[model samples]
Target: MSAHDFNPLLDIPVFPASGFAPLADRLKRIFATGNDLLFIQAEALLALEAAASSLGRPGLVAVNVVTSPYGTYFGAWLRRAGADVVDVVAPSGQPVATEAVAQAIEMLGHVDLVAIVHAEAANGALNPLEEVAALARAAGALLVVDAVASAGGHAVDIEGLGIDIAVLGPQKALGGPVGLSLVTVSDRAWAAMQSVPRFSPSLLSLLDIKEAWLDRGRGALPGTPPPLEFHALAAAVDRLEAEGLAARITRHQRAAKASRAGLRALGVEPWVADDDRASALVTAAPVPDGVDASALIDAAAAFGVALGRGFGDIEHRLVRLDHTGGRAAFGPVLANVTAYGAALAALGQVVDIGAGAAAVTAVYGEA
Candidate 1:
């Protein structure tokens, strides 16, 4: 490869400012939202921070749902911006009860913003978004969601759910690049952002993202567009559509069900007790007696069993087995169960690896 040679593999086409809105249109289809969408140059974390920070000026009261560490991050950002944040904290790895969220909303008097994570992929805790969204609707609060881990694998209809601002990352189950954050902003959210003077133009400004794109004919992108990542995003969207989102979601659900059943055969149980309440993309569990989750994670790695670190406070206490995006298949489900059983055995815990694998196979076969 000569220095002057334009390697198509390494050198991608420059993503034009005009190309952004069209790509965002495709991304909006992921959540089935008619709201205005913005492609953030950074990860969903930064996109969320920008939205929450700008929405959290003085006199703002927010009812923040705390089911995972992501929620904690949002609450902190809102507080820093002088918002009185009411955190409805649920136990780590467990779904947030809808009742608690309603109670929080009632107690808050007037909530200006409502923030929640749709799913905690780190520890497999899924929140009750529909009910919470209803509460936010009744309160007339701007609802913000970090749907990074759930958008692809889970059913997310931002319009139907009345989400004011939804931050999504396709890297999780959408199999897209990790560098971009696809954000859908509602008219209500834009109005709220406009009221804050501190919401000025910057990398951490959601208004800047909207204005940069919509203010002047699909306005200029803030920095040099990340061409490769944009290409990766497009490719991922194409692949997902080819497979069909319904089929993709079904695959993750089957993988999760298989993982839970197989783990039971191995004398292990799910971290979140209710199967329906947990995330379909990840199967998290407590490390059995005589074994540490961190140690098991490392041991599993030796056999190429890559897993997600537990989210929030359960990082060291729990373990996550992923069945997301490209890995949400029968083959990956079987491999995950076998590796988990093998790791348990290595930790001096007697588990039926064969039986566990068979269970996984049976579950996937049923699906």
Candidate 2:
């Protein structure tokens, strides 16, 4: 433990910074787009706020889709920046419909931007991003999507889908660290960002990052980079590619389907009724009427299953079953649901112990 006492991690250099740009290039390939991808040093939410704060302009009109707390904050950030925002909010446990977006655009006649979250892990809902992106394209509006939870689990083609800015986080679906946020920018998005005036030299300035990448040539980052997160991200990208994106997404899809079938057998209602509208990463279900959510979660933990805590108003009535990245495998799926079923039985609920696990195995064993 001494200064020069053969530290194993000492060989891992965090400073010379030679590996930064090539990693960014690899990320662009993973995204399946030929756009500029910036690796910001923080979580995905900060990356999202940076996008809104940088792109939001005065006298601009936007159609903001609100399905969760993040959507609500996105709208507020834009409004605070002097943008005329039109919010298209959906009910709890459901995604915003494409028809709703079209109607809003029709009513507004013109819009400068359209912001939406690709999936809501908060309530297990997946938005119709392609259809919403189409509406934004038709109205000549820039589209920004919070694809943090959907990046590895779902298909996100930023350029092909007409998205101006698509934000990504490696922590959730990619099975990477939570300290880094990657944003992919289209050429059109660059134009919109530059044409506007700057509020100040904001740390979240996409323009500055763009300058560092494009103008200063390749292999250059604007400031001191977070090396640990960068290296971890690289490792995750390698693992994902080896498994193949299609296979990873299919695994997530199977996991979600299995959880839905299994949770239904347990008498708990899925927060999102339609499987098509649910996120592949999370399966949200209400805790049985008489069971205390905290106690149930504690019970699951006692059996070695860590359940995600629910958020917002439904925190007490709901529980989140996360099956993402490493947990999307058959083993983790069975463990999580089985733990829940056992916890329910302990709480005096009439639950089928073997049935919940059988549903998961049946769906996963299909291969």
Candidate 3:
């Protein structure tokens, strides 16, 4: 193919650089945040690391809640930036309890920041963000939340919850590209970050972003921007606006309920026993004894069904069923549950596939 062959996809017009700020504004609307919003030209993890670098320093005490690997990474970043971190870790396949957070805060005497993941997509758990946020508020600690997996699938009222910093990845529940990430900074967070000198004029510098893009009247980004990602993000936001945020969240909730019901009918209890503590993005079940998790996942794939394995230590102990973004629908949820049942049956486990399918359909019907 010649360079000038006029391929509609490759020959598209460039994404105007002037639209960057307006794009950030659109994302801010989705988050319902009144604080300053910035778009990072990389994945959400980079934005998270940048936030940690900008806020962490010597003499700062941070309470980092660990339910997933993302939380662990955030804590590590804070530590690398010279903050004294108090890790509040939860058990496998569960969210951190609010009481544990309270205990950590109480033991610390004073906390400069409280960091948490709103949802653990890796293991299908939902943290008690509202309760934790209230505790942080009482302790006069700035709240930092990783809402990459929970923003669209769950309610995340940044301003209402008093979140000083929020990191969002639109690729997960927003059905967007992964090449860009969004960050929201509250006034309190900005003030705190101004005191940190660890972040220099690097690509991961939030201060540089504030000075270049934010303070300069909000126009084009400072460095060269990836047009493809910007355009894709705009398209994803358009879809979210068309569907309505509340309705999108309802769809994910219904999918989770149906998935849990189907799994229960198959005699497979969800990893998170409590419904309220389970994430709407994914449903995970413990691998039955004597069944090879890899074999079962392969069997599901042979049946043209795509299933996921748990991350980190739980990779071999549990199976993950994704019901996020486009897959948060009756067809995909039922297909996932049915595939798991079939995989079990293929692996010599006695399961009532008929009952499981019925349970899934019934839940959807009720919805």
- Which candidate ranks first by lDDT, i.e. highest? 3
* TM-score of every candidate relative to the true structure: 0.95, 0.95, 0.98
The alpha-carbon root-mean-square deviation between model 2 and the true structure, to one decimal in Å, is: 1.7
Each candidate's clash count? 0, 0, 0
User: Which stretches of candidate 1 lie above 4 Å from their native place?
Assistant: 1-10
Query: Candidate 3 lDDT (Cα, whole model)?
Result: 0.91
lDDT of each: 0.84, 0.86, 0.91
Two-way TM-score contest, 2 vs 3, winner: 3
lDDT of 2 by residue, 95-122 (tens): 9999999999999998999999998888
| lDDT by residue for model 1 (1-367), tens | 7798988877777876677767777777755788988888888889889888768888899999888778888999989988899999997678899999999888878888889888788788888899889999999888898889987788887898898888889899899999988888888888888777654547887787667667766756777878999889999988988888888888788888899999988888788989878898788978776678788987888888886678667877778888888888888888888888888788898889888988988887775
Model 1 / residue 319 / CA error / Å: 1.1
lDDT per residue as tens, model 3, 243-300? 9899999999999999999999998889999999999999997788999999999999
Quote the lDDT for 32 in model 2: 79
Off by over 4 Å in 2: 1-11
Count clashing pairs, candidate 1.
0
Order of candidates by lDDT, top first?
3, 2, 1
